[model samples]
Target chain A: MKRLMNRRPNRASKIFLGLLPFIIILLVYASASSQRLAENADDKLLPSFSSMADAINRMAFQEDKRTGQYLFWTDTWSSLKRLLTAVFFAAVIALSLGILLGVIPYLHANFSPLITVISLIPPMAILPILFIVFGLGELSKVVLIGIGITPFITRDLLARVLEIPQEQLIKAQTLGANTWLVITRIVFPQVCPRLIDALRLSLGAAWLFLIASEAIAADGGLGYRIFLVRRYLAMDVIIPYVVWVTFLAFMTDYLLRKFSKFAFPWYYQASNKA
Target chain B: MSILLEIKNVWKQYGDAVVLEQLSKCVSAGEFVTIVGASGCGKTTFLNMLLGTESYSKGKILLDGKPLPSEPSQDRGVVFQRYSAFPHLTVLRNTMLGAELSASPFLGIVFNRRKFSAIREKAEKMLESVGLSHALNSYPHELSGGMQQRLSIAQALMKQPRMLLLDEPFGALDPGTRSDMHKLILALWKETGITIFMVTHDIEEGFYLGTRLWVFDKVRFDPHNAEAYGAQITYDIDVDQSAKRRLKKELELELEKSEQAFGASE
Candidate 1:
């Protein structure tokens, strides 16, 4: 018989182990909700699973009395639009700036310190300033998300570009590559997969900035809906919304990971060895 | 024979520390010149100077009686012991990269199907010559050390460079693979008649592969400060095939003694 320290779980046991905690949490929540409901039927803090289901149906399936809009779907659509647009803009800006700073010695010398300083500043501290300048509309929310993640992603990508082997660059130059050709053929291709990785890592921060801006000022969004229902103690709706947001974030990260593997198989292979 | 490259009293220094001092040599076209030296003898630095990646502190390196460019150009191709091949590119793409860069200087890609195929065909032939034809689509990381070195050679040869610089290219390989690489390099050298400058730690490899062998050693020594003096080409011997076997034993003993003396000086 193997000692406990030496013992390792098989594939099936590993899967079971992973799910055990989630199952326990769910069971505890269900028991607490039942007990609270038994003590006081009017309890709103820990709503029953059935009531949460009912809230989802109302928000998603049923039309809102005032706007005649399916509140849940509208909130999801608007939030996704802002998030995707901001992310796209951030990615383009970060990639361009990162590559420029990484490749050109003068630009790197001048801008790297500035970028580092910007990254050090807490993005949320400038939330009020962003809202005032860009207004309380969609622009402000998008800008907040863009500003929040751009510096981090840019720094990450810049480091990746710098990490490229010097010999490879010399090799490229020897192969008849000029500066432009070296960047495009060698540096750009190598930095792309790393850009994807940087974006994936920054997604959590992006979402935080998005939700904070939306909660502070927005016509309709997942964060807006969740915060608005707090007055009525609508835990049923809030809980479901939070779970949905988590699922969306997870799905985005999953898709990005899959896409990176598909598009840059070589990068993944090299990283796996390292 | 025409002199392809000439070094006229070249010196390389970083800050106050000298790496190579007053190095002078003239290399003819199609000659295989192998360099052997102790570690930190500035052999790699000298190679980098010829490749135009490193600037000389003084004097000049002339190619075809003209001052060599301060930056690397297509006329010279280089292969390091590692990181010579791009990890992200497949074997075929790596080979095709040189031609592609020349074809589309700005973009470094060939968008036209016919042009792309032509480059691809050329790359395939180069890979076949290097014996890496079967692993065309495999990335560099997937390759064994010898195979990666083969790929590096194929990639370098793709440009049809007039001069090839190899910096300890087979240092990482096993003995069997190193011997195999030796055959491949000699065959390529004979067929293409490209002037070769190879740096090796193994003195035997230098004698075996080169038409001429150079030994780099520092003459002046400062016991208190190691950086006070830099290495110079101390010995240059012409190695004809007939005389190589006879010269090997004597040269090996002499170099060993000198190497021991160099260590003692330090």
Candidate 2:
């Protein structure tokens, strides 16, 4: 406690220091926006704070005349639902496949080379193919996110599973665990935290795929709204939408980190020592 | 002193390179047998075969006058030098793993909640026996080196196995901690009457801890034919050194190079 108190800056001050850069960016943007609006009241390049607020209020508070629904909440719900569905299925598939490949050499030899080949292919390069194969719909978008991130997540988790020491496996066997028992009881628990870690890393790519597919073709989503507003030079709506997406991604990553720490406290403490 | 394990001229070879040749030993129930050997002298390999993780090229190992299972079983428990306790589990959970595995090998302890308290109670008793009752919820990494080893030993003993295997169990501990562990092992042995087969690189530790000690080394090695030789029991001694002539004869047999016990290779 003494050492913590004796530090140059306290924890609260440190947090404030961390927020300084964000404050500076906001100030610079506000100045640039005000100056542009003063120069030309019709300037759409840098929308004023009032105009951005007006746009958000229209999208969030007022229902659209044509659709009879709030665009902001509808877009957020759709995008989040699609993203979560894709990530959930990808995590499930990757967890099982990674555990099997890591434990059984025969399965690893048969499938790992194929997984490696697939992982090397750029996910963006196959976007057109996904649309072509699955067509321009929800299926294609979700599949795009799954295909974009599944192999990488699987590979990450497979490496983690393989990193489990030989001694632990042998010990489990000595305790009368069969092959299935070892995989489920011994290997599965240890791999769960790694799965969350892999999912957290692949979230960025998952969001990128979601936005790209939505931009290409979507009726309603944050990405679609951004692209739709681009024609009218509605910088207010576009910038807010972008910021919202970033906030959602940040929240997801934070939640996953917190969940892993909560569920597997031992993992965090053990890894901290390492 | 009933025979608990019998090895009949066991020979282990990998392809054409021999690792152990014509090795045999009889271990009785409730006896502490310490094996001291140089590095690369097949000590770990022999232990692996005993644990049923590795296959022998020829001969057989019988436990309780029956052929031992080809794979590891609940009858024999092992404590490795490192990674003895699962870092992801608490001390109590690690100790309960054996009973949990045996009870429900399909689902594991997580879904076996009906018997969890029983297992936890047993594990707590074992931890108390090993002087780690206060660390029940502590992860393996949170404990000191000596404490970790003690937790591991407690984990192995919780199963009540007929035989226990220790592979360089105290090689990484400091002298002070090692001495404490030595007392713990002796006490546990006296209380449980479980046969212990330990392999160590410390000659003094082997002599001090065992009722019987065996030194493994290459009896014949040709420099030109590097793969021609294999390890065998070079010296076997009963810890009872009352016979002065035999004690001196055994003491003169490469005991001066005890310091090289950890360094000398095949």
- Say which candidate scores most in DockQ: 1
Tell me, by lDDT, which candidate is best. Answer: 1
Fraction of native Cα contacts kept in each candidate? 0.91, 0.80
Candidate 2, pairs of clashing residues:
none
Instruction: Name the 10 consecutive residues with the lowest summed lDDT in model 1 chain B.
Output: B257-266
Candidate 2 Cα misplacement greater than 4 A, ranges: A1-13, B110-114, B243-266
Candidate 2 structure lDDT: 0.88
Clashing pairs in 1: none
lDDT of 1 at A158: 94
Collision count of model 2: 0
Task: Report per-prediction Cα RMSD to one decimal.
Answer: 1.6, 3.2
For every prediction, compared with the true complex, DockQ reads 0.88, 0.73
Residues B104-163, candidate 2, lDDT per residue (tens digit)?
Answer: 856776565668888888989999999999888889999999999998889889878889
List model 2 lDDT by residue over A1-274, tens digit each. Answer: 5686676877999999999999999999999989988899899998988889999999999999999999999999999989999999999999999999999989999999999999998888888998899999899999999999999999999999999998989888877788898887789999998899889889999999999989999998989899999999999999889999999999999999999999999898888822
Question: By DockQ thresholds, what CAPRI class is model 1?
Answer: high
